[model samples]
Target: MSTTLTLSTFDAPARPLNIPLPIDPPEGGWTWPPTSVTLIAGENDAVLIDTLPTVEDAADLADWIEASGKRLTHIFITHGHIDHYLGTAPLKARFPDVKVVSTAATAGIIAEEQKTKRDTTTYSAIFADDLVEEVVIPEALPADGRFDLEGHDIIGVSAGQSDTSESSYAWVPELSAVVVGDIAYNDVHAALIETTTPETRKGWIATLEEIQGRNPQVVVASHRKADAVNDAGALAKTIEYVELGDKLLSTDPRPTLAEFVARMVEANPTRANVTTAIYSGAVQGLR
Candidate 1:
């Protein structure tokens, strides 16, 4: 049988960001963007496309995978963001036979995240009890970024920058799916923590267009609404969101963090994690 794909979403609730912000959160406070983890299942084995963040969440994810009854042969990481890989060790412990892999650049970034304790220190303080303590770095994938499961090919496409640097995506040929970590955010605010300038924003759009050029039927975004459908349409939505961010930030006299957040909320009132996304942009992008 050909490979079939599925997803599990973790509805991570909004929490207070411990770091100081240019403006305070809305009355309702901030919520984190939900995470989506994909599973590509073949006849006898499966490949997990991404992992969740906290130990509790990963254990829950592990339970969900165990219920599927497919032997997980590999855990594929699409990027270096801590939220994408923090739960890896727990998953590794549960599926010891599964090999964890990512592009060499991603692996390098993962190492750097660990060395700098960016996640362990900052995120841990914010997430408090939800964060993972054990750090598990992945092995580097072959330079070509080709791997397989049950004879089907899964290639890693280079995504120069989206939310963060050294990002990449997983392309499954037989399934016509691309597991794009943060390259796209469906019905949610795009993470612009690292995407500041017009050039970088355009570059991100270029990368999304490149992924679109691949003509994949299924586009799995790492952060999305729990009920959002996976389809090629997300590519356009992400591109539009990035463009909106650039437009808002590029005014002759840029809006303050408060005005920026207010305008974003006005535009995307229904999008989840609006405060956190805008606050992140204010902190990183506005600087």
Candidate 2:
């Protein structure tokens, strides 16, 4: 029997920690919201982590920032995925002074993808026409360093490799919190990897361990609720998911992608999207 887990309400004083972004391609029957964006407020200024998947959601976040009476000093792009970065242009418009930041690798990918979409009309049709015109690539930030903002230090960690050459993680020491993009997913699902290697996965596991060692009281994931992370529990669950994918890949007469996905769903019915994402990642890895 599958059990339902209810998340407690997350209320923070400075700004709303986790704001659910409406999921697109809504026919997938995904349980939890597909994307989550976080706002980390300091004494003087605030930082907005990954914008949502849509313009409306990004506007909502901007409205919330305006209401908080804190200037949005910076906007952090966790990765280069469309769902995470596509809504940034509007957000930037709302806070014109806020510096949009991302890792060098992610910045390059964003620019390259934007150019490709413009060059090939075939792929351009995949995105909404309005969105294509509004897309704005963010400036690149140092991969591994700390930035002083509003009397608080924001640390950036280039944890491991992903679709982009480097994945950036943001850590706020004062809050004992970290905004980990796709590096660590919460109760949702892993993202489909455009580029990932076995060695990279191992390195990602190590990075997770390092983050856990910091004893952060709160962890804001890119796609799930922002709350306290049971380090051991979350990491263990990720290990299990990755191990299952490895097992499925090692089958002598390898199962078809659809078959493997079906098996995963059967094994963990409650985590439907997560199972599907894992299967998708594994299939991509095989290719």
Candidate 3:
């Protein structure tokens, strides 16, 4: 049996709270950051990686999955970030029997985040009319750490702390593809709010190097460039952002957030989500 990999991207709506970038964004406003989801479809079954935050987006995703004419055996979340997994509840409500799986570490975070569920306050208080109002926790997958659909296998590789703790990627060896959640991003400013040190930055780069070592033909990320896909350039750009961050910050004077944004924006002027980088630039670069 043969298997194919498909991609889906859900661009989030603008947030109610405008990010306080040091200056007006290059485009003079915010960019709608997208959440990319991947589907591994085989002869008899399929596996989906990641979900968007909004109910409307996730329902569209569920419909897309159902229209594929394949049974969704498992939905694997690459990490536990609220935006990545918040829609799990709605997705499951649509596909009641589908198993929501995450790494053991991600599962812990989900359990804790859902237990308290304070994160939902932002959406309810502000964008109350936009999406689902619940968090659905996922169970840890089997100890073997692989999902088999039809006759193919999807392996999970742990990319520790690239974007968040307990983060990982789903590798489809048979198809030479890997769904690299936030461990890698393309043409979009990465969220460095979590990785805030030289050591951690190196760790982030190392994880990308690990993915490069596998030499997958396609690389999929949670946030991607317009019309982007899993490829060598995508991987290299991710490595570049982390490397540039460490180098620029290591220099004397420790550029302010605005200065850092100026340098980066000059180099990659066309990348969307410029506001995201500017918004978190100083904080991500500083100690």
Better-scoring candidate (TM-score), 1 or 2: 1
Q: Model 1 compared with the native: what TM-score?
A: 0.92
TM-score of 2: 0.75
- List the RMSD of every prediction in angstroms: 2.1, 8.5, 2.7
lDDT of 2 by residue, 128-223 (tens): 322324556878776465665666677766666532346777787766777777776556555435334556556666667777888877676665
User: In what order do the candidates fall by lDDT, top score first?
Assistant: 1, 3, 2
TM-score of each: 0.92, 0.75, 0.89
1 or 2: which has the higher lDDT?
A: 1
What C-alpha lDDT does candidate 3 achieve relative to the native structure? 0.74
Task: List ranges where model 3 is wrong by over 4 Å.
Answer: 1-17, 20-28, 122-129, 285-287
Candidate with maximal TM-score: 1
Task: Rank the candidate models, highest TM-score first.
Answer: 1, 3, 2
Worst 10 residues of 2 by lDDT: 1-10
Instruction: Quantify all predictions' global Cα lDDT against the true fold.
Output: 0.79, 0.59, 0.74
Per-residue alpha-carbon lDDT of candidate 3 for residues 182-261, written as tens digits (9 for 90 to 100): 89887777877677778888888888898899888888877876476558677889888878877877778888777887
User: For model 3, what is the alpha-carbon lDDT of residue 135?
Assistant: 78
| Candidate 1: worst-modelled 10 consecutive residues by lDDT | 7-16
